[model samples]
Target: MEVNLIVETLKFLVLGMSTVFMFLALMVVVLELQAKIIMKYFPPPKENSLVSNSTQELFQKGNFSVVAAIAASIRSYKKKSK
Candidate 1:
């Protein structure tokens, strides 16, 4: 009777361990699937900005005189602070 009890306890332990492992495996699969779906629809971010486009256009239009004047004004302001 003692031997039978030992055998039954061992069986229960094995079954419990297997159930835990199965649950962990299912969780991993679900996480991976969610990542794939999010990436497919949302995608990653980009670094492009409208300010950069406007700056490029300013350079192309020969507006350096305006830029120089603005820089000089900033320099004068800085000098006044000192």
Candidate 2:
């Protein structure tokens, strides 16, 4: 019957969605656990003040133009890929 078909279609859709949701949830938990393990084992290196670029001046106009070109190419590439 039509009613049975609709109910079956809904059941299939629910099952597919639930499977995807559970998979994504599991991936999140696994990735979080991996991050914690890695961080605990290998701590990040300390940044020395002498070699830091924190107080550097802003980029020049030519550098800004180059960066804009790179950004445009990256955007176009991403659009093509998608």
Candidate 3:
């Protein structure tokens, strides 16, 4: 009967969706646990003050070569498109 078919289809849809949802939930939990374990065993290195100061100094000294290159590329691309 059509009614029986509809009910069966609905049941199948619910089962499939539930299985997918449960799988994703389990994956998230496992990944979080793995990250915690790795962090505990081998933690990230602390940043040194000397390295931080040097990075700041580099920024303070305007580094314009990178900016110039990007602008040149954009200009070349615009010319090519036209």
**Global local distance difference test of model 2:** 0.74
lDDT of 1 by residue, 1-82 (tens): 3579888899999999999999999999999999999999988765433344353566676778766776798899999999
Instruction: Kindly state the number of residue pairs that clash in model 3.
Output: 0
Best by lDDT: 1
What's the true lDDT of residue 62 in model 3?
Answer: 67
RMSD (Å) of each candidate, 1 decimal:
7.1, 17.0, 12.6
TM-scores for candidates 1 onward, in order: 0.55, 0.53, 0.53
lDDT of 2 by residue, 1-82 (tens): 3578888899999999999999999999999999999899997776543443222221332356556666798899999999
Model 2 pairs in collision = none
Residue runs of model 3 more than 4 Å from their true location after superposition: 1-3, 54-82
Task: Give the top-scoring candidate (TM-score).
Answer: 1
Clashing pairs in 3: none
Residue 50 shift from truth in candidate 1, angstroms? 12
**Which prediction has more favorable lDDT, 1 or 2?**
1
